[model samples]
Structure formats: structure tokens, C-alpha cells
Target: MTASDRIWQAQLRAHWAVLSARRDTAGVATSGLGILVGDEAEILAGVDARGDHHLLVPAGGGALVVEDSQAAYIRIQRCVLTIGGRGRTFVDIVCHRADLSELFDDVISSMLTELATDSREQPAVVCKRVLDEWRELLRRRGGLLGEDALRGLFGELVVLERILAASDTYDLSVWHGPDREPHDFRLLGGDLEVKTLGMAGSMVRVHGIEQLEPPDKGDLHLIVVRLVADHDGLALPDLVERIRPKTNDRRAFAAALARAGYSETDAEHYRDRRFMIAQVAALPIGDDFPRIAPSSLVDTLPDEVSALSYNLDLSLLLPKALTDAAITPLFTKGTLS
Candidate 1:
């Protein structure tokens, strides 16, 4: 996927528009991108205009994750940066919500217009908001196997970064250098580098390959978020594990023993535990393995873009009446001689 095709682009456009319009008003600093606009009061007022409550989905692209229609809001939390030469400046927005009451009607109205338009091809997933930015992305969504992998990586990155920041204490401090490797933060001073282990309910054997990387020297860390899915694919409840892998690797085997209270030495000794449901462990450093750092989390993940939302799906927000016009034929006339 190109730079802007991600869902964040949609929120970026709306946010940038809001920020840009305020440029001309008096008392506003012309700091360009350096000017921060993430005043919680202003954001809260705007979101409150749409609805009373806003859900928190750290993984969402500044998007809202509320129960269906209860809180109609979409907010993209982000840290926008503007770098000049060597200096760096940033505007961090912790998006609470977007009051959709006013905009929803208009957004829905536009769908009415789109339905009248004449178009024959299927409605592509190119987010109109950022199509201009991601002109390089031409792959079809489901057709290309790689696309899903990339999307999942992007989604995972968004989730991970947000979780780190959402903690009671937040810090954007991360290590990077001239090498420009994707996730090579080989700084393991007192931190731990981790990999996700077993699943929660299903029978698939769980042994993390990434964790095999040499442990960070001292403090570096890595976090693994594993979701244990049941037969139907829903994440099983709870984050504890009952079983573990049978391996010479003691660390891997320990979990199984702990969960099932089984001795590590027995043959087939891994079967005693129930396994983890859905757990996310953050690693603070990297190992000797080429590029296994928190920054490199994206590189390790598969590309896939799936939205975890509660109130409303973005697709529905777009409206089917409009999509029908773009993807399906409005008229069909047949006459045979």
C-alpha cells in the first residue's frame, strides 16, 4: 500500500483541513506543521457535538471504537511531525472523538449524490481522502496476497505504537541511527525482547520464531501480542495459558509447565496447560537477530488492514446507495433481433 491509502489518511485529511482553515484567523501562530492542534478541550467540544461518549481503540487510526451509533465519532490520534534540516518539531493529537451529528447528515447526503453518478467499474478501496498521496499503490485488496500482509503489518504497528503511548506514562523516545534498518533497535540494556507464545483455545502448536533471537544484551525489549482464537475464529477469553511447546528451548517449555503444572522433562509433557487467550507483551529491546526491535515490529508483521470498531463500520459510514452507483450498473436495456 502507498503512503496515504491507510485509514489514517482519511482522518489526516479531515484533521489537516481543520487545522489549515484556522491558519488565517488572528492569534494563530503560523508554525506550519509545527503548530500543534491537539487541545483536548477543543477536541472534546467537537466530539461532544456529535455525541456524548467516545470509545478508545488504541489500534484504531485515530478512529473511534464506540458501541453502534451510541457515540458517533471518528478521531485519529497521532503525532504529526515537521522536520527541517536537522531540527524536529511535532504536533501530538490524542483524539477523543469527532462529533458526527452535523457532519454525518452531510456525509450521508453526498452518498445520495454519488448514487446518481454514472460509473460501471467496481468501487475500489482507494480512500478518496488520500488517493492523491498514495498514487503509487495500485494493488487490488483481496487479489494480491502481499497486500493483506502489508495491511496487517501497518495495522499492528498502529496498534503497538498507540498502546505504548496510551500508557499512564507516555514517551515517544525510541532509538534510530544512520543504518536506517526497519526495526533494528539493538539496545537491550535492561530491557527484555519477547515473542508471542501459544494460542488460547485452538489446537495449533504455538512456538514463536522471533523470540529465538538472541536476547537483548541488557535492557532492550520486544513485545508480542498473541490472540488465541477459538474454532469459529473469535479470540478466546482470558490471557492465561494452559499448554506450552515441547522444545529443547527452556523458555518456551516453561510456559506449558507453568500453565498445566506439568514437569518439563516428561515426554509429551507440553499437553497439560490450556494456553493463552489474547495477550500482548511489549519488548523493550532487540537481540542480535538482524532487525528485531520494537521499531521493526512492522517488518515482522504480515500486511493486512482490518478495522476493530464497535459503533459503526467505516464502510457503512460511506453508504451503500453511493457505492451501488459506482460499482453496479444503474440501467440495463436488452433488445435482440
Candidate 2:
């Protein structure tokens, strides 16, 4: 743990002592930092009362418990963060005793900073945002990829390499964020979504119907990266480290990594795996590309069929594939600018 963590832990201990001393009373105990810790979870009101920004974490739950998904941790009755008050004057962001990981410390520190600096947003809202961010970060670290970690990491690397090669302004921030983003990388002129396959597979999974659908005015291209497991190939950490120096803002790059679910704690696992890019194919989302857009299927499908997903065989898309020479220019600087 860092010095900051030690200080925060000390403060928490002091706060808990005060709370225990005043257990019989129903009032707020103001800390040296001016943070009010109420006796209960429902009545916290030192900050904004909008309720959207408020977060209540439980206190004294042994040790910090980090989990794979936000739902799993947040939804449980154990030390969890929740919005809205049940009539108590305080909501505690519980610090678990099992694992006081750096991530939790950072989260607590961030919430306190936000509370101290920004009075416009409700505390609940601030807490919610912080929890959500951490949850997403944890998801990226291990949840989303699950068993397909190598393939997913390779896909992201392919996109990152292309972006770095194409633009001097390339940053990891552009490559990772909310997975719901329509494309993998958002550039000046258009967006690029990258798909990767382990073997010489002809099919690629289209996550959602909107994945292949381009923005109304800009360009959207799909890049298929075929990879083969190579013992001597580059590890995920090596690729990340190599690109880290190229980023304009290191803080943003780190935030982007957290947002994408990549954590330093799990870096060792990825370093053990290696892969080499074998083939690259690029296809522009045009009239000729094989895809199903909601606009096109809205009238044909049943009204009840709101969400749909399917796979497309690349063998069928061979005729539309951009030649290697043609695809190279797409990654060149100013191609999107």
C-alpha cells in the first residue's frame, strides 16, 4: 500500500471510532476533512440531495472483496454501494477487510475528492459514477474476455497498431472505452471496428445489429485480423507498454485502460500468452457489404424482435475484401483526417 492508502485507512479507522462512540445518538460526525459520516445509510445530506449522485458503502465487512462483475458485488447484501436513503442520515462506502486493494483505495480517494471539490452534483451521483467506473474496470480486467482473453486482446492490439501507424495523434483512449461504442476506434473522418480470429476461421461474431451499421454521415470500416498462437510473438503487456510512450496523455491512457477492464494486477496473466498476426483484411461498410441494419429489418421482422445478433461468414465476403495495398493507405496519416 502507498502512503496515501495508509492515510485513508487511518481516517476510516478514526471515523469508525467516532461512529461507535456515538452509536446511541442520532446525528452526524464531521471529520477533520469536513466529511460528514451519518449514523445510518439513508439520511446523508451534507452534499447534494438529488439522490442520483449519492452512494452508501457498508462499513467493517472484514476486508475488501473484489469480484468479477459489478452486479455480483453490488447486488449482494455484503459491503456494497447503493443509491438512495432508507431514512438514515449517512450512507457508508464500506471498506472491506479481506482485500484493501489499490483499486478500492483509489475509488475512495476519488469519491472524497469529488465530494470536496464539486458541490453541484449529489454525493449519491458521485458515488454511483465512481462505483460504475470501478465496476467497468473490473469487468475489463477479467469478466468480459473470460476464456477468449487471447483472441480479444489480439483484436484490440490490431486496432491499436493500425491507429498508431495511421495517425501521429493515436492514443489508447481512442481504442478502449464503453464496449457499447459502435466502432473500436473513432478517428477524424470515420470509425474503425476490428475483429480477430485465432484460426483461419471464415466466420466472425457480430456483437450487435448496430455493430456493422455505420454512422449516418461518416465512414465505418471493419478490419478482420487473423492470428496464430506463436511462442515467440509479442505479449499483451509488451504491446501496451510499447504504445504507452506514444500516447499524448499518460493519465488518459491509464484511465482508458481501467475503463477497458485492463488492470495491472492481471498483467502477468496476459504476459504469459503470445500471438502473431498472420493475415489482415479490411472491408468498408458499403452497399455491397453483408450486414443487417435495424432500418432495413425494422419492417420485415416481428415487432417483438427488438434485439438480434448473428454471424457472417468471411468466405462470403472475400470478393469485397480490400487488397493489402489498398488497406495500407487506410491506416496512413491523414487518411481519416
Candidate 3:
């Protein structure tokens, strides 16, 4: 576990201790331990009349917790937990089994860490995602991403940073690559497909026919980011942390990062994986561009060929590259589609 994780665990235990002490002394029917987890979100650790331990996470924006969202380790529901005569709605998570309290602490620690990460998502959304991720982790352990995946994610973050810099209204949901969308970013004016290559590499891999296909009504542009590993350059974690503050919705951005298979827990793994940009080329996909799209292959190809993957040599497409000034306009012109 990281130092941050340890601190969160200690804080949770301290809060629980105070609540437990109160439960024993006054014999109160219920007690709450409310404390700030992040800049805006507050957490409440409580002891019920039956001595059941509960953790209440503020459910921002009136987000609801569904009925009986329980697992073997914890029970979850929505309720208004009060302390010091102040009431606030929260997603209440209960650990009835004493033997599972340690496990519960770990879970709460993870949730607090996520909440504290400058997330802009609703508190309920962040809590549920953390719980879901934990459930997946326990079901089958997963390892850190490979070098190629890391580079791809790094390139996407670079572009996202550019987009954020170019516009004031940041909507992280438009970044659909992590969700396995056909395009990496869906902007109002067009859709963008980002490809990351080695500094010396020439070929750009086209994953599917839909990849280069234009949006239903807008244009499509392919962004090629060529990078080289350098000791002086920034690592994945550096870029992530740098961009986190610029985004208005940090939680949503964090969730997008998580979906892309990047996590703070695995930051140590990418410490040495620093990258320097070699070049960034923006090429608008049009009729003249070389690509295999469903529209281009209409009625001519065999039905048996359901999928396609190929490489395009970037050296052959120099004339198509857009200038740096032109690149920013593509992201800035469109509202999030």
C-alpha cells in the first residue's frame, strides 16, 4: 500500500474508534462521525443501536443508491445521516459482520483515497465505482498495463490536456476512448482518433473500419503523437496529476483514467516510463485519406471479412499534416458532441 493509503486507513480507524467509544458510553441509539474526506465531500462513520458499524459517504447532487446493493462483506443503501444537529444525505455502507471489519476498513480506505483524488463525480458515483473495482479485484487479480497500452493512454492524456487548455468548459465524458468508443474524443465539430507511435516509428495502426469513419454529421481527424522515452521527460503519473487540477470535474476525469486501465495504485510501475514528444501531427480524414471504411468498401468486399486491422506509413502523409495553430481550433471550435 502507498503512504496515502496508510494515512486514509489510519483516519478511518480513528473516526470509527470515536464513534465506538460514544456508542459504549452514552448508550446512544446511533452516533455519527462526520469528517471531510476531500475539499468538498464529507464522510461519516457511525455505530447503530445494534452496534452495527456504518460508513456514510455524502451522495452529492441527490444521487440515489439502489435497494439492497449488498455483497458478503458489506450492505449499502441511501440515507440521511446526522451529527451535531446537521443532516446530509449519504450512501450508507454497513459492515454487520465483526470478522469483516478489517476488510471493510481497507474498502473504506480505497473509497476515501478515490474521493480525496479531486474527483468531480457525484459522491455516490465515486463510492460505487470504487466498490465495483474492489469487487473485480477480489474476483480475479489484475496486473498493471503493458508498455504499448501505457503509451496509448499517455498520448490520449496529452491530447486531453490540450483540449482542456483550449477550452474553458471541460466535459470529460467526451473522451470516449476508455469506454471503447470508435473515436478517442467526440467533439461538437468532429470526432478525433489518436494514435501514438515510437519516435522512430512510421506506421500507424488502424484498428477497425469504424476508426477512421467520420461522425454522423461532423468531421473526423486523426492525431499522431510520436514519442520517445527520455529520463528528462514526464512520466504517466506526472501527466495525470498535472492535468487533474486543470479539469473542473476531477472525479469524472479520474474515472476516465481508471477505465483506461491507469490507477494511482500502479503509479510506481510507470515511474521509469518517461516520455518526450517527438512530434504531433493532425491529419483530417477525408476522401483523399488512405483508409478502409464501410462506405469505401460498399458491396465490393466479402461478408466473411467482418473485421480489419492494418498499418499506414506516416512518412507518405506529410502534406496532409495541419499546423500547430490549426490543431487547437479543431478541439476548441466544437462543443462536446
For all predicted structures, in order, the TM-scores are 0.23, 0.55, 0.61
Where does candidate 2 stray beyond 4 Å? 1-144, 176-178, 298-303, 323-325, 332-337
* Top candidate (TM-score): 3
Cα lDDT for residue 293, candidate 2: 72
- Order the candidate numbers by TM-score, best to worst: 3, 2, 1
Per-residue alpha-carbon lDDT of model 3 for 26-140, expressed as tens digits?
A: 4333433344643355676777766677777766556666634657447678887555677667788777766556557767777767766766776677777777766555441
* Tens digit of per-residue lDDT, candidate 2, span 159-229: 67666766675555567324558677776666777778766687888876788887766788888888788
lDDT of 1: 0.26
Rank ordering of all candidates by lDDT, starting from the highest: 3, 2, 1
The lDDT per prediction is 0.26, 0.56, 0.74
Indicate the worst ten consecutive residues by lDDT in candidate 3.
25-34
RMSD of each: 25.7, 12.5, 11.4
